[model samples]
Target chain A: MSTSSDVDLDEVYSFALDLAKQAGKMLDDAWRARCDGGPQTGHVEKESAVDLVTQTDEDVEAFIKQEIASKFPIHKFIGEETYSKGSSKEYLIGKEPTWCIDPLDGTVNYIHIFPMFCVSIGFILDGEPAIGVIHAPFLNQTFSACRGKGAWLNGTQRLPLIRNPIPPMPQDAPKGCVFSCEWGKDRRDQPDGNLHRKVESFFNMAAEIGGRQGKGGMVHGVRSLGSATLDLAYCAMGAFDIWWEGGCWEWDVAAGICLLKEAGGLVTTANPPTDPSTARIEDTKLGGRLYLAIRPAGDTEQETGRQGQERTVREVWRRVRHLDYPRPGA
Target chain B: MSTSSDVDLDEVYSFALDLAKQAGKMLDDAWRARCDGGPQTGHVEKESAVDLVTQTDEDVEAFIKQEIASKFPIHKFIGEETYSKGSSKEYLIGKEPTWCIDPLDGTVNYIHIFPMFCVSIGFILDGEPAIGVIHAPFLNQTFSACRGKGAWLNGTQRLPLIRNPIPPMPQDAPKGCVFSCEWGKDRRDQPDGNLHRKVESFFNMAAEIGGRQGKGGMVHGVRSLGSATLDLAYCAMGAFDIWWEGGCWEWDVAAGICLLKEAGGLVTTANPPTDPSTARIEDTKLGGRLYLAIRPAGDTEQETGRQGQERTVREVWRRVRHLDYPRPGA
Candidate 1:
């Protein structure tokens, strides 16, 4: 809980990392406890039919908030569960030093013990993410970053930011680039939803990636990590070329945003960018729009410029064509 | 290594588990060694535009085969890489013991380090999975089973055999009931590619699970855990229901098939059953049909099944109308 007045940014980052480690330990303990045949006390409700919410989720969120508040009373906080109940009031740009948290990001995976879940904590100062700490306790891995400092894995290893140049579009999607997506909360209601369309776009893009040489997409494959925080962290680590999500709150992405930015990756709209610098993180949400997070594909690759990752992503977005398709040619 | 004359399944089970552990370690070392900073050093090429192959993938498969041959000379082997070169030469049923291995199931996820990858090994005696082992080395989890004996996690904790029954079909697919599938290799090149149709059907089923109550599809959610072996293990553990896959060889599922059956789960073809006894696992692949590994759901709220599990799973499966789409949509 180091504040601007009490400590430098580095000190604050170190403190955040410490808190994340502590939180990570709690999650690990909880996971083990549950695994050891603990009580089936949690409720089974689908946030989206695919997304699960249980008491453990609430418990984890409360634990993170309590620990953070007790240690650093002055820092502002916005957490997922709380935000769902009106804590989102302060997430605006130019806010006080705030820590946005998704205590257990992949709740659905955790409930099933899928092991792709994580604890994410992000620090925002003056409307921009300054430092972020994400821990996948189950995997025993941590990713952290500060604005001026480069991103690091497990504290000692410095990670380089890398993305391949958007190779020529194939007649199909590359079979390798795995796109990560969420099923969201209201898929059944929509049937032919923008999300479904988005999924189709992903398939279409993947098709293009694997399509014949003349008709392909840029990425090789797609994946849905089940957690936004982990998805961003994966993108930051160059494990994925693009991560797009809609209907997510700041807490779900706050920590990942910092890690992604620090990794020299860009998180922008899936739609064409009208303005670049003036674009704020909040802009990531306009139009229920998706955020395209691309790793920094180097100089020769950068020659593709704005049309680079941004263009490839936007092209996929536009190529989606329809959010809802007629049910099986009916 | 165990033949019927003098073979103790337990001993072979123990040996295979040991081998799994050793192989897992090798995989861990390789994974870490490859963690050096760089955009992944491989291109995803789809032969026939449906099958995907990468250099590191071939190397990993080769490394695994070499290690196994060096350690156990008599055990017959079948692997994804090997089968890629030629169709499986079925082992004599009830004859000598043989092994099936997916050196890396979920290779796409492995390439991305999405953490759902695993080294899978299934031992067959008399044409049945006698004992099976699946290890996600990076995740530090190994699921193993010996026929007539319950499955164990990391060799200590016994997994619950009863699963939550497949709930009624959701209007949208739920998130918790993960369905693991792979895009067929040479998808477009294949005949009548109903691949997209299958994907669309999956989307419908999965989306229903995540849809609103009375609206969303069955259970809580859907997931593609990347690795077929692990996905089946999860199903056996009741972590998910209805894990289906197409275009995968016995190597990708042999170990998991045993685990699922032992855990009280059921496996069937998505198509109509013609001959249940001679279901040669591949019959589940009705002209590129899908494999369904379904767990019985119970009336109890706990993971433990009470009454509804079996009937519910059967009913739900029956409800999912078979898609008539061709394998490689024409």
Candidate 2:
């Protein structure tokens, strides 16, 4: 029960960035300790047999929660590790002025000494994220956003993400564009060749974008950085034009969603919204997964902009068609 | 010529790090300049397309060569940009000390303001990489190696990269594990769908590794960091177990070859050697566009003092089956 006019976005954004940096310091300390011990011995719990969560996860989350309580005692707060335990059902999310956090997103990677992890702090007021901050301590990079004012990396400087039309790709564009994807945990449930087909087509379509359907086109390459939040942040910066991800939760994307939107990047389901009118992109509620299309900033050609991106996606989808699997979580 | 007795391991290692950092600083300056200006404006040249090469690439390479000339006056150096232009084919690698440098490894990612790129500098002596250093400035991480002393990250710290046997992967590790494939400048020569199948199988095998494949082992994952050197660097760090790359030149893998081997990792062509006995890894003369695998350190169940890294690699190879492809040059 909040209106834009009622909330002070500038104040909330400042607070979010502060919280994110504090949480990032906590995560960075744990990461350095874990890397020091070598990749394995850092485990504190089991996200899976191979995957792990360290004490830093809990310590960081607790620190963030404590700060939020002191600053805005009336607000609701949710964290990933705690949510994994219980207490968060509709009753909590249905509440107003809630703050969502992933104290250290990409915990497994952090444990394994990969540097793509980040601390995500998102402020959701009236059931929507109004201010978001993503801080990656190792890189000393911070992406912050306040509703309507746009997003900034580091601070103050707005990022305007724009891209040219896709149908007729720019001639100079690399035919091998890169992408970020995840293997997801539920590997056993997929059809025999379905998963393979999906990834294979991803490559195929990248090769074919401006070229013939099966001939190589404009994409030059694809890469997987293994962190959803970082992936989204890069997309917002226009470093990557498209990011397709599956099997991630809202916390994995909420802060990044705000960042991407503020940077003028577009988010849609990997599967097109059945009813675009009702699509709830805020939480990627249209589907369990998300596909983000980011364009670089400029005076863009609207028709070309729509078709170029749509075509790139369609091309990827066409390639993915070779692998036939049920939508995840179905 | 550098014999084990002649090479100053510490000095070369330090110099490599110094060169990488200096290059990194130059790249940083260019990065800031680019950020201040709008996106790079221009057409893709015959040398490279996209505004991929920033002033950073040129400045860093120039700085590296200048340093090499003043410090290692007698040593020959080969770099990406210069090497891309014609050099006397007769200047073939010999039993002389030479340096292979890729000042900014992930140029495209760098131009896009992506943080995954790095500066890779390697020293080759007697036709084999003697010392190597890869500095990823954005991530604030540097990976290095001295032939016999073994590899280190940030120096001083040894990479005790030994992973306890992955408890006989519950699923028989599939032959279709993650493959780091690239869609380079060759698209029309091969159909996109044809290449897509390789990606499809990669996913399928990974998805079914634990369920459909024997022992229900699922294929682990795939990553394309975009830079061939960084890809190998990750493999060297054991961040990735295998990195299969095709459609690249010797400059792409030269420095990485040293670090990969020094990390107790293994490298072999995707296709079997025509004469396995004649496959002299130390001989830089054999240049081909093909497969490369970097295996991590693994403990042998047997108490032999030697690391049983080979057994693990053989086991991995047994699990993976490459998608058949018609030879590119043939």
Candidate 3:
């Protein structure tokens, strides 16, 4: 197992950035072709009818895999397409250099031409996310970050794009905060199912501040853009104050987590911490299927950045129902 | 009172387009200033706590009104900011040529820097929408149209951006259809309230096709971008197959409806037509509080574009709960 010190972070980040852009170009070409009267790109169901996969998704994954192999032949890889097809259903993230990729993160958006899909590539060292890159061809934006360094957009702008001092989380938070969440492919509506819980939680979050029998959150706004990667990326950019989701794989969030942390944000499990006093952002597991992300905080006389983020997380956790999503090999 | 023929639509459209772009620039400047450490632009509640209005919105609206009045002094005007403050609560759509404008649509998105807000301008002649222009500053894209002419994006690409022959609505749709809807500011969750109905309808639309006790529409995707104007414009662009909503004013849909019609799309009430057999897209009321916009359809030997649209609408209507929203003067 190689330590983080053994890797040249600059070279890896540069390579990942170039690879993400190349992959984005391929996605753009296929999208343009479809829009320009090319044969319709048919899709097939993956886990369910709502979960979809397309030829372009597979092709992009294969292309990315080949390029990485030629450039870093010794590095291991865990890609969405390959994992879905592999006979072994377990994910192995050992303490070694590995690339975790979601070649096409928003497949449904891609098929519908909604212009929110993207390519996400995350590099893990010592079983922790070290470098990340994501490119959205339609939006013409690229976000990248390396551990201990800063996050960036289009390789220029330091993120949270708002360079100004951010205001501390509102006293009545989850209120006056722009929250982002997704309706995952899990549509089972049983009383205890994730879908039912998600719907109830969403309703509660958007309800009047004192409505819903005192359970209302009255969030400033709620957005579901159908792309988890972009959702996390936007959270990192300070466009969203909070993002919560479940039923997503490690590849879905590995890159986004790195970007958010580099931007001075925090990531924790979607569920409330079992030991509130000891809860730490560093304790967040990469393969944890449920995740909650909070934007960086503003320093003030009464509270520091970490204190504000922790308070906001606790407030948000109380408003949401506990969601359950089995970890790989659990 | 000028008839459609009595007005010069080409000249009016040109003026509206230029005005929208100029308004977009102002919005862009203010946004950049706010991001670059300018004093925070404070907001106040208008109709409710969820409904907000900032100084920038008022300034932009005033600027647009002045530009239009100077260019066409004889024309009437109905701007959102002015209407919200006026003594007369009734909306009067006389036969005179008029401009209906929403200076800053998606105020929440703009405040959050979510990049989906826009300035919308619609020209009404003969009591009908004749010219439309919408400019999204952050997105750097503009949509425009003139009656009897074609709709366009950025003055070059034809509307729909998809030149290929679009496929007809699927046999079981809202299934396999990309649907767009919004959770409006009305967050009341009473048993029979619009908010409750909307939540129920959204669940039904996203639930599994065979689940939900056969009530599921199982849409291919559901998007809530927090912008009514853009939702309708995307419908015109053939990206969103269906967009249903209530609680939006005429200024919100007038420009979008014009763009949709010019792109061969259709607009009808969100409620099921009183007499399905007699439901005609041309009969859709501009001031109707509820709306459902459908994208243009492809030609086929068996079904024409209109037929395809009607079929899809009926399918969608049955799957959603009936929602009630009062008209402006009701």
Q: What TM-score would each prediction reach against the true structure?
A: 0.81, 0.80, 0.96
Q: Classify candidate 2 by CAPRI docking class.
A: acceptable
TM-score of chain B of each: 0.74, 0.77, 0.95
TM-score, structure 1 vs. true: 0.81
- Poorest 10 consecutive residues by lDDT, candidate 1 chain B: B162-171
What order do candidates take by TM-score, descending?
3, 1, 2
lDDT of 1 at B305: 44
Between prediction 2 and prediction 3, which has the larger TM-score?
A: 3
Per-residue CA lDDT of model 3 for B1-330, tens digit only, reads: 445566777889889999999999988999888878996778999877779999999999999999988988888999999988987667677789999999999998888788889999999988889999999988778999999888998888787767688766676778888889998898876877988899888898888877677878878788888899999998888878999998899898889999999998888888876655456655468887788888877877888878888888877776777778776465
lDDT of 3 by residue, A77-106 (tens): 899999989876666788889999999998
State the number of backbone clashes in model 2. 42
Q: What DockQ does candidate 1 score?
A: 0.29
> How many residue pairs of model 3 clash at the backbone?
0
lDDT of 1 at A103: 80
Predictions' DockQ, in order = 0.29, 0.35, 0.68
